[model samples]
Every structure is written in structure tokens, then in C-alpha cells.
Target: MVADGTKRSRIGMGFLVGAALVAQPTAARAFNPFGLFGEDKPAVTANAVAYDLQVQGLDGKSDVLTAVRDVSILYRLRQEPPQTGDELVRRAEADIPRIVDALWGSGHYAARVSIVVGGQVIALDRPASGPVRATVDSLRGRALVPVAVMIEPGPLYRFDRVAVLDQRSDLPFDPAELPPRVVTIAPGDPARTADVLQAAAALSDHFRDRSHPFVKVGRRSPVIDHTARTVDLTLLVDPGARAGIGGIGVSGTKQVDPAVVRSFIYAERGDPYSRRAMADIRRSVARIEAIGGVRVREGTALDANGQLPVEVEVTERPLRVIGGSVRYSTIDGPALKAYWAHRNLFGGAERLRIDGDLFYFTGPQNWPGGSNRRGFNTDDIGGRLSASFLKPALWGTRNDLLVDAFVQRELTELYTSNVVNGTAAIRHRFTDSFNVRAGIEGEIGRSTDVLGRFDYGLLGLPLAASYDTTDKPLDPTRGVRVTASVTPYLGFGDAPDAFVISRIQASTYYALDDAARTILAGRVAFGSILGGSIGAIPASRRFYAGGGGSVRGFEYKSLGPRTLGGIVTGGMSLFEASVEARVKLTDTIGIVPFFDMGQAYAGSVPDGSAPLRYAAGLGLRYYTAVGPIRFDVAVPLARRQGERPYAFYVSIGQAF
Candidate 1:
């Protein structure tokens, strides 16, 4: 027999939040809020008594029953025996309202709970546990109590209809303005009470983002039908007045000019209030690593003229830092890198960094910088050192100036060589989607090939333009990124050639689902050197395709034109294409199947005579906070006489 309790009225659905509730389910997982356990009860002290609480008669609604059982205080009382039997009975009696709350949370409003303690019944409506408490106290002083809780969770309530009632006639109202299923409480679905309040807030935010600075969501009780098991909702909204931008101020800046902070703000005075504009400014400020914290506040409430003032506060981070990393690969053995950076060199968001790398401690020296000679040896080693400086906001525009210099010696399929290069570039971002750069570089290098040794100096002017709409640079799931660059070189010494090397590369990605669990990515690139013969251009300057970042199955630069001695001759033209299907099995683990093809032509342009090399590969990725750690192994599908049958690559980022 169940005791009838004084049931509280259901909570009315109404506007409560500043933003409209989207239908997106934000709950990570279904939870039993009352701490219900499927396992045996935990052991208690020998002196302490225990209670066995079982929630019975769940019918087919295990999910709802679990939610109520998990959070029920009666379960807690069992875990920790009360001081007296009467106290245990009292605790159970006082917990009926809380149990009802849990049932409501799961959209079950017509639930009834019956409690039986030691064969004595407890009434939920009586001011106390009454006769059950008296009987329990008389019979047991410090004995274990077995409690059985029988629950009857009736039909779940679902929203039959939902509407927004705009009370003010001065403001425009269109039913279509609200997002589809914003409340998430649709007809025929469980009407979660929380979704109703969330939807109200979402509606308010929708208007606020559109210049309604003082919009308000009012409260109203929803109409609940017991017989039909449905709820009808009407959300009240008071859109105060449309507002415009007012005075803007900046503060909390030290060691950085106030003008620089102000420069990042995109909103203008007297313009319509825009949340996107303000958010963009905040994002830009965060891009400067030196700025650690930021707060954007509306300084004034809506004025008589409907203007809201704004203020931005910033906290500066440490200007300088030092960090390093170490990586090991079967191809390169072990490599160590270290760097120091000054993010605000001149206090204008300028950056300066010095970096160095050392590798090839015990690997084959036959690769670049492995040895000073042409032949392969195990003792060959390579090292690199470089420095770069970047000046942001060049000339008060969204442009940057970069100067870089590097010296290194490395091995390639053709030869072991030493190179020194210096470059200066100016990059201008027209918008988020497009950018262009122009730069001049000078290089001096000496290299040895199977044929002989060569030395040269060169100067070049390089220009590049790109359009990127990818969501993430490290691992993009959607959008296209295209980049094209041309470099005109003037060589000095024996092989003086005024050749223009041009290249265009493009990558496109498409996510197969809303969660981006599966992605299709494709890439293609083409390059050619003009006005110079194969021998005239330096080996390092010529194009070649192979290795981790290129045709994976082939050895580094081994797929290009080759001499009679089987040595790779760097080609005058190059073409490469690849496609990968990336599938994320879990949030942190992913796999990719890829195919690659490339051709390196001896002539300035591919005339179809050069053989194309094809490779197929599988890759694994472990997603991390910074990026994915990638491991890939590939095999040549169309193997050539001298090409390695397989190749493997390991790196810290995506291949593309």
C-alpha cells in the first residue's frame, strides 16, 4: 500500500535565460542524480548498522528509475547508518520532496514512491514517519534496517506546443526569427523542464546579439494536461529597445601601449551593437600570447538614446619564455630542439626567436649532412640553427613584417650539402579568408652529386598568396585551403640562370557528419622551374617529391629523375597529389587511409614521359591538446627498380 503525499504543482515553463536554448543536447551522459548503484552495498563499520535500499517496480523505465535511485537520500542513510532507528525513519520521511524533484528532472511528474521499513509502512504526507518510527525504535536499537522503496513513475510529459509571445508592439516580431527546436521540448518528446528555461535564455540572447540590449524573458505557468500527458508552453518576451554603440575605453594594460590595445577593437562608435564584432576583438587580443587575460564589459546601461558604453580590460603575460622538445624517428634516429622567444620585443607585439636542432647521432650518414662525402655512411650527422623576428601591426595595418636567417647542412638523395639563407618578407591579411606575402631571399650553398661537385650563390624575389577557410590549421575537417607562390632566381657563378620557379598547392576537406567524426581530405600541388636547365639549377633548389611530407612510400627525394648510377637527380618540375579518409574512432584516437601519386620531370614541364610513382598508406593519430601525434607506414604500389618497398613516418602533426 502506498501513502498519498501532498504533491507540489509542476514548475511552469517560461523564459528565464538571456540566450535562446538550442536543441543541441549538452549533457555529456545520462546520469542517476541520486547516486543509485547497481552493485552490492558498501561495507560499514562493525559497530555501525546498514540499510539495504532497493527501488522496485521500474517497469520499462530503467533510466528514470536509476536517476531517482542514484540521488535518493535513503541510499545515503544506508551507506551511513543513522544514530537511531527513529532518525533513519525521519530521514526517509523528509526525503519525499527530494525524490519527487529527481523524478521531475527526468520529465516524470506523476511518480509515486512507497516506502516500507522493517515491515512497517511510512506515510509521505503525515508530518512524521509516525507509527513506523515508533515501531522501529521499539524493536531495534542498533540493528541493520532493510528499506524497500517501490516507485511508480507514470507517463512522461512531453511538450504539445510551444510559442513565444512578444508583448511589445514597438519591436518587430517574426516567428521565423527563433531557431528551430530552440527549446528542445518538442511535441511527442519528453518535455524536460530545464529545456524550457534554457530556451528562454537563448531567445533573449538572440535578440541581444541583434541590438536589443535590454530584452527580457518573463515567467508564466505552462498548461499541463494530465489525461493527454502533454504540456503547452508560452514564453513571454520584453524587448526593451534597440541600442547603438557608445563610448569605448581601455584599461588594465601595462608595458603595452593603450593605442595598440585600442587598435584591436573592431567596433565603432554610433554603430549598431554587435556581439560578433566584440567577440572578434576579444579573439584578436587573445592571439597575442603576451596578453593572458581579457574582460570586455558594457560600462553603461541603456541610455535615454539607447546607447551602451564599452570597456576592455587586459592582463599581460610574461613577455619571454624558453622551451624545447625531443623527437625520435626510425628514419632520423633522435633529434633534439630548443628555442627561446620574446613575444613583445619592442612592446608592440613583436616576436623574436632563436632556435637550434641537432640530429643524426647514430643513424646512416648517407642522408643530408650525414657525411662530407657523397657515399652513405653510418657516422654522418646533421645540425641546424636559425633565428627569426616578426613585427605585427606593421604601419598600423593588419600586416606583419618578418625577417629570418638560417644555416644548416643536410643530406638528400642527390648529395650532402651546406646552405645559408636570409629572407625578409611582408605579409598582409586582407581578411580571415585571404592573405598575400612578398619577400626577397639570398642564399649561398655548395652541394655534391654523383656526377661531381657544384657551388653557387643566388638571389630571389618570392611572392605568395593564399586563401584559407579551414576551421583548424593543425587538423582541418572542412573547408578548402589554397596557396600559390612564385620565386624568380638570379644565380651567380658557373651556373648563372635567371629562372622562375612557380608552384600552386591546394587542399580541400569535407566532414561527413555534424560531429566531424569522418573527414575526406585531398591535396594537389604542381611546380616547375623555367629559364634554367637541369644542371644549371642547384640541386637543393630543384623540385623533388618523396618522404613523409610528400610521397610517403618512397624514400626522401628518391622518386624523382635518376642518373645512370641510380642516384636521384633533382627534377626541374614536380607534381604530387594525395587523398586521405580520416576516421576518428574515439575522441582521442583516429585512423586514416591514404593514397599518393607523384611525378618529377627532368624537363621544365611534365611531358608525360616521366614515370608516376604511386603509394598507399595507413596512419594513426593520437589527438592531444596541441595537435595529433601521427604515425604512418606506406608501401609502394608501383615500385620502381631502385625505390625502397616501404617507408614509415612519425611526427607531431598531421601529414598535410
Candidate 2:
């Protein structure tokens, strides 16, 4: 067998180069390569130029030399439109070098290849391009490349009985899929290397796309030989199966439900080995109720056919529930409190929180300052309970049912009050990037007027709707959210002439990272009491903005109309706006600094006073799987003679 001029230099080795015409190994069967797939493998004239693929000192004469592998097979092929036999030969002549390298890397160091005249690379049709049965026909023996080197495969390749070899051989590859999630074999036919690989690819894709995203499926080639002109092969495969959950075991971190992680796994005891399920499960081990990122995958495989004893290995995270400190700011003075919380409380994304605070404050005796408070005695205790149910795949979307109940009753020089409320709602996400929500809610409560004398009762039903899609709810990276709600007495006509009450809030955020990891957010909320004797609705019912979650600069519910005597005085309406930059500095920390503007009035700004109240501050946050721990210290820009320079806050998650 003699290669064209491009062959290795027999002369370079200073040896006599004889052009030996070796006998045809055997007549390749008369069968057509394409015909094996039930389509005719068309024959082309063997007219391409013969060439030798030369490598430094390497001889192509030895039968052991095989093709070398290239990173991207497709990239190496120089496409030559097979317009005619001659042109096809030219392309083949040019590609011989790459082919030689490929052959060698593939283990055939001395492979002898000859192109049938007008040789072409044949390819199978992708199922979707056309009918499966007919598509292969249309693509039958079609040339993907012209002037190709091919050993006439006597019997074309077809899958025979497959055997899996591994130290853990008990868990054989799923044979049903031929190339189960563990391995795939090309349909027995006149197969090309690419087609065979396409079959194998499904194994990795199926596993990664579902449970074992991190799994690495390395290639184990099928040996082929056409000496008898019959190429037979065996597939070498690695299960790459990781630990799956055998049976969930629980201990110390029991506050959060283990079921929460179970649902995330979407896997069961009998599920395939998975690392992801365990990771997600471990996140619920914490005490705080928050959102955290987790990865799941099959872990140690039990060498059993898909029926392996899966192991759920979790890397537990920081405790979610933390007994912590609390602090707040007010127009009167600054105060600190003690707090405790159970984050992943009932497990599965539920939260239980409690807080107790005490602060000493003094206020100026003036109409604008809401006068008459020079005191150091202030104490408060409050808590919140929230639970949620999330079903992402149901309803053709991700939907959630949430319920929350809260009470903040306190006795102070300012007031002695009791307030209780419960709310149930539904939230639906239409897209990973967009959301719409609507719900019906009701609240009933009573509280002491700031002066500790005037007591008021309030009852109302509120309807609300919102649209938003920020990366992080509390600290959004991009997108805008609009929320508006109105609470009206069930029957105004039958109830005390309380006409109608309404509140509206809107917020927007934009991501700074081109990747949208961090964001800049701004928000504004305005509310008013409208209807018969709106004043009768009580001080608690009147809308007020401020504190850690609201305006941030002032104390909670402190930004509203009031008298120098610190009474409800009277509230016409309230308006609050704030600008903040939410930075996801790292996976573990987030920070935000903001400016707030807000105020309350009784119909009109008392003739000569500017009703605008402003505060600005910086916040530090610690990121946890359960969201973030927040701390902010805000100061009022315009002090009313005797207000604190700064108000500090401690809480869970971002203020808003």
C-alpha cells in the first residue's frame, strides 16, 4: 500500500521506500452503508487524490498507528462543497493531515484509509428535521463532506449485546434506552462516529438536566475493526452516579421540617443517587425562615441498577434562628430592644419571630414636633408568624399560598394599645422574570392614642394587586414592582359613616451588573383615611411610614399627623419615598445605604410649617441562606430641636 506524495518520508529515515501493492483485505460486502439503515448507501466514483498524512518521524506504515483526537472534530473538517469528483478530491487532499492526527489519537496509529472516488462524509438526519423513518432516507448516504477516506465497512456498525465494566458493575447501565441515562449506543446501522456520539450524549444530558447536574460523563470509545470488514464494538462507560437519598435521617436541626428539603429534592428514598437533594435538604436545618441556594445530585451509587441505596449527604449551613438584638429610632428619641427568632421555624419555609424593645426618648413641646414627651420609659414586645406553600410546576406556573399573623401591643408614656391581625393571600409567578399577585385580606385592631387615652377600634377588608420581578425580593437587582391596595369597610352604608380608606405603594429597582447580580432600588408609598369621621378609625388605622422597613430614618408608624400634646392630633394623609442601593457585595454579605423622605398632615401643612420629614443612613447586611440579617443607622436631616442624631436597627432580611 503506497500513500500519495504527502505520506511520511520513507526517504527521511534513509530507507528504501517500496510502493507495495498489498492485496485487498477482503471484498467489503456489497451492502450499502446507508442501506443498512434501510436506505441505500449511494456509491460515488473513487476519484479523489491519495495523500499521506506526515508527522515528525512517525511512520504511517505500521498497523498500530491510529488517529489523534482534536478538541472540536467539526472545526477540523475543511468544508468543500462536493460540486464534482475533482473538487471533492482537492478537499480530501487538504484534509488528510487532520484525518491522520484524528486517526492516530483515536488509537489507529497506522490506519490505512482510501477514499472511494468522490468520497463523501455521510450523516444521519436529526429526528425533528423530518420523519424519523423517512428522514434517514432523505439523508441516506448523503455527503456531509466529499473526498473522504473510508474503509468500506463490510457490515456497518450495529449494537450487539452491551456489557458494562466498572469496579461497581452491579449497577449496570440502563439497557432499555440502549444508552440509558448511563450510556447510549447508536442504533445498529451504517453508523458514523458523530451519530454514535450523539447517542452517548443523551446519557449526560438526561442526568445533568435533572438531578446530577454536576456529574461528569467521560467518553469510553467503542472499538472498531473492518478487517473481516465487519466492525464490532463494545462501549466503555462510567456511571458518574453520585449519592442519592437512602433514607432521610434527622437530629439536632429539627425546628425546620425535613419535608421542606424533601420537596425540593423531588426525589424519594428509591430515587437515583443525588447530591442535589441532600444539599437542598440541609438548608432547612437552620432556624431562620429564609431563601437559600442549594445544589443537589446523586451521590454514592449502590451498584444496583437504578435501585441503588442512595445517600443524602448534606453540608449544613449556619443556624437560621438566632437570639439577637433590636433597635429603633423615633422623633422623640432612640431605643434598643432584645429579640429572638426561629427562621425555618416549622421547616419548609415557615417563620416565627419575637421582639422586645425598650427606649428612652424626649420630644420638643411644639405643634410640628408632636410635643409633650420628655420620657425614658418605653418598652415594646411584638412578633410575627408567616407560612407559605409553593408549587412551582402546578397551575402551569409557580404559585404560592401565604398566611401571616402579627400583633404589636405596647404600653408606654406614649400609649397602651393592643392590635391583632391575620392575612391569607395567593401569589403567582407567570415567568421566572415576571410576576403578578392579587389577594383578599382583612384586619381588626384597636390601640391607645399616642397620649395613652384615646382608644379606637378598626375593622376593614383590603384588596391588593402587584407586579414585580426583581432578582432578590428584599434587595432587588433589576425590574420594577408596583403595589396598590384599598381597604373599605365591608358595608359603609350600614357602618359608622366611615366613607372609604385607601393606601398605595410603588417601588422600582434596576440591576447594575451586566450580569444583574446587584441592584439599585427606590420606592414610594402614600396613604390616607377617607370616609365618614375618618378620625374615628383610630390612630393605628391611619397610615404612617418610617422605621427599619419603611422610610428607615424615623421610628415605626411614627411619621403621621400628631399634636404638640402627642395625640392622634389628626391625620389628613401620609407620603413616603426612599432611594437605596442594594449591593450583593458577595455571596455572604449585602449592603445598602439610603435616603428617605416622608411626612403626615391634617388636611393642610399647618399654615407656616414644611411638612417634609427627611432621614438618611447606611446599612450593613449579612447574607444567609435564609435571606439576610440587617442593621441600619439612620439620622434625621432636620432635627426638631431634640431628636436623636441616629436610629439603629437590627432585623432579619432586608428592611423592605
Candidate 3:
């Protein structure tokens, strides 16, 4: 093949030169080479030029040569036609230096390239347009060019020695004394220019992360030894003075008080300056959903007291917002929800929100002229209204206090009643990845179901905690999440009852590839109510599976123990598990195939007596920067009477 390409290149060059030499008549009318009569063109017209690329003088097929050829314009000219043969020659000549540079980038610094076209040695450094124009002036019409690129990649260069010179030894530790945390390449490793440059950058970042924000790295020169085929690098550094926290300033906050903003700072005055601590402060401030943006400025120079002055600037989001959503499904015909919130109530970064939702508004007796109530009752008109308040840094620490009050009337497969409740909770984050919460709640309600009708009052204590190591909360391709909570309730009204409800859930994600285009996700949850009969506990507190967020094939809260009349009486115990493979078919589109199984039982422990529900389905996802828009369709593996053949769901984010 090499010989054939060489022979073709020689012939191609000869043809071009011959056409130019025999072009005296065409040169007289160069401006209009068509014909003297303007319509009588030549019968023998030139064809479009094409080339055969060849790279020689290599021990084997080298990746460096492949990279060069892949990026060569000479090779691409065949796919993208050039106007003339001279233009083709110019591009081929220009690619020689580019090929050499690419070879050097791949660690072959001592590489040579030679370009031969039609048996003529074209000067690799010839000006692109000047000489090519003069040569092509003689040639007319179309022509084919055979090009050969011969490469001689010499011995690869490796690093011999790498050192950094620190001008200021006044710091606590010398650069030489400390461990090499930035140097990536060692002696005898290929001398890649990228690795050398990256090492310098990492070293500079090391000092900046260690409180030397003003540090500067200067004068980087790698001395290359051509004979030994090795590179020795020396980098000069000037690390300026280290600093301590001098003063903290907050600005750009209108509705949020300065004290609220200052509370996020992890470092106090007189403390040694730390970039990590400053970053934490920035993150803490950003997490306050009310904050639109945050900018931190470190003092360019230390103060007279030899400390740094830090400024925290933050823009506040709109203090109030009102929005709502609409949803529908076969189980629940239609539902609408509306909510309003004040992000910075009373200028303390406190939040107050009011929410209202109406469900089954167009079914049975809930709306006029309604008839399709197969899975619903005539009185299943349900609505809820609630108000909640939140205070951050309640005690000048990473703790939050929440207070809530709500009144609701609801109807379900199990029962329908009106209820009112109040709750108070305190949440504290122990670290960036772990947190705990404790709360107390009181309730009063009336419930009417197949069992009977009763009025009840209850008081409860709830404690919960979680550990999250996922890289992202909305969409995670890796890491684990775990949560456990227990709430104990004591009934005080006419029908007195008591129960302790506990739930534990966990999920994990693993990326099958580096790009995170494919992920295997799994989840499992267990919940139960101890020390109480299934009828005694409120229907809202009972455990049931089968919904968009649960076992998908079944209806919402429809998979559980039932009354003799066939009404679903939500169970006292629950267990569920799901596995999904999320594969991104494109940058914005993805597909998920999943399997789910779970069971709800009357007793605390989910014994083997009651059969578990199983479901398998496929889902589609349209990904965006914020999250994915999800659409799922699921069918039961084990069919049941009266249940729909399949279930369909639409929402945001992944199922897990």
C-alpha cells in the first residue's frame, strides 16, 4: 500500500506539472478559461482531485501517527474538495508542522514529517498562498492529487528531574520539606507537556487552599536534553504572607438581616484564614433557598493587625412567591394544589408558607353530573389547608425550628373524615452529610369507615435522622442514602388508642460508565405500626403501597388488606423494593426499565401469608439542567381482579 501511494503521489504531481507546462494557450486567456466563444468549452475536462495519504518510517502502527493523520487536512481534502491542485498542495504542506506538533503532544518530541506529491518534494514550510498561486496559474479545470506523508517518530522523551524553588522560606514548612501533593509525573515517565503544566497549577492551588491566597508561581522553564531524550523542569514560586480572619462584612441583603447572613460564616475573627472554611460559609449561605446569589471577596492585602478582611455579598430572592400544580391519573381523576410562601418573614431569614390541595373534585358527589366512581365513593370530596413556619439557625448554630398547623377533610378507600393538627420540630445537621430531627404533634379528627364511625384525639412524638453521600440530591448517579424515623402516638378522645409507627428506607446508585450515561439504581423501604389495631390508627398514618412513588402497577394506597365489602383498609405493616436501570439514549433523553415488589399486611411484621405485589415497567426521561421529566408505564406481573391492566405515571426526577 505504501509503495502504491508513493507511486500515485509521483504520478499526481507529474500530471499537475505537465498540465501547467502545456497551458500556454490557456494562460493567454487565464481570466476566462472557459472558451473563446464563451460557450465552446474543452471536450476533455479535468476531474476533481483526490489523494492517498501514507505515513511511513514507524516501528508499528503508532497512536501518535493515527492522531496526526486523523487531524490532517490533506486526508480531509478528499472528503472536502479544494478549488485547485495548488490549494491542495498548500494545505498538504501546512499540515507537516501540525503533524509534528501533534506527535510532540503525544510524547514524541523528536519527530519529523516529509510531504511528497506526484514525485515532487513539497517544502513543508512554503507560504500557503504565494508559491501555490504561481504554480496553479498554469493548471486549469479539475485534477486528482496523490499525497504521501512520511513520518519519522524518534525515541520518546521522559522526565529526568522536576523541582520547585521557593523564594520565601519564612512559611511554616518549606515546599521541599512537605510531601509532593501536586507533582503527577515522576522520573522515567513520558514527558507530557500537559502533565507538567497541570503539576504547576496543582502546586499553586495547594498553597491557596492552605491560606496562602496571595501566593504566586512564576518562571516555569523545562530544560530539554535532546541527546538523552529527557526533560528537566524547574518552577519558581513566591508564596505571599498567610493571613487570619480580621473582620467580617455582609452586604446586598435587604429582607434578610445582616445577623442572618453573618451566622453562616464558619470562621470567626482572629482565626487563621482558611479557604475551605470560606467555601463552607459560601455553601451555607447558598443553601438558604431565599438567597439568589452569593459573592465572597477576600482582602487583597492583610490589615494592619496582620489579618484578612472578608466580605460576604448576597442577593435576596423575592420575599414572597405563589404557585400551584395540576395532576391527573386513572386512580384519582384530577387534583390541584396551590401554595404561597414568604422566604424572609420578619427579616430573620424565617419562612412562612400556606398550602391548599383539592382532590377528586370531579368525581361522584364531589362534582355535579358525575358518574364514573368505580374506585371512589360519592363523599370522596377531599381537601387540605396548612400553614408552616421555619426558622434557621434557631440557636446560633446549624439548627432549624419548624412549626406547622393544618385542618383537612379527606375521603379514601378506607375512610373519610375532618381533622386538625399542629406540630413543632427541630432539625440539626451534625455534618455536611448527616442530620437528625425530632418533633411533637397533636391531632383531633373523626373517621367513618367499614369498621365503624369514631372521634379521636392524638398526641405524638417523632424522631428521624438521615445520612446522604450522594453527589446530587435531585439526580444521583453514585453514592448511598439512608433514612430512619419513628413516631409514637397516644389517642386521648372518645376512642382512645396508642401506636408507635416506624419506617426505614435506603437507596443506592452506581454508574456503569465514566460518563454517567448509564446507572443502576435500587431502593428498599419497611414501615410498621406497633401496639395498635389497624382500625385504631388514622388512615393517613397507615402504610400502603402502589402509586407513582411506590409499587407502580397498583393504584395509590390500593394494595393492602381489605374489608369484607371489598374496601381497601390500609395495612399496619409494609415492605417494598425496586430496581431500575437508567440509560441515557441521548444527551437529553433516557430510558429506564424497572422491577418492583412489595406487600402490605395487617400485622406489624410482613409475614409470608399475604402475597407480595410484583410489577415491571419501562420509563422515559427527558433530562434538563434542573432535573428529568419522567413518564412511566407499569403492569402487574401477577394480575388481580378489579385492578387496572397497567398503571401510568408522570412526574419530575427519578423514581428512586
Best by lDDT: 1
TM-score of every prediction relative to native: 0.80, 0.42, 0.66
lDDT of 2 by residue, 121-190 (tens): 2221111112322322332234322122343211222333344443245345555533444444433443
Q: If both were scored by TM-score, which would come out higher, candidate 1 or candidate 2?
A: 1
Off by over 4 Å in 3: 1-250, 265-279, 296-311, 361-380, 395-397, 510-520, 564-566, 581-587, 641-645
Using TM-score, give the best candidate's number.
Answer: 1
Instruction: Tell me how many clashing residue pairs each candidate has.
Output: 21, 64, 4
* Better lDDT candidate (2, 3): 3
Clashes of 3: 4
Residue-level lDDT tens digits of model 1 in 241-339:
788888888888888666666655656788888676567567656666567888888744875566888888899989999999888866556788999
Per-candidate RMSD vs. true structure?
6.5, 21.0, 10.8
lDDT of each: 0.73, 0.46, 0.72
Q: Which one wins by TM-score: 1 or 3?
A: 1
Off by over 4 Å in 1: 1-95, 114-124, 127-150, 167-185, 194-219, 237-249, 264-278, 294-310, 361-379, 633-635, 641-648
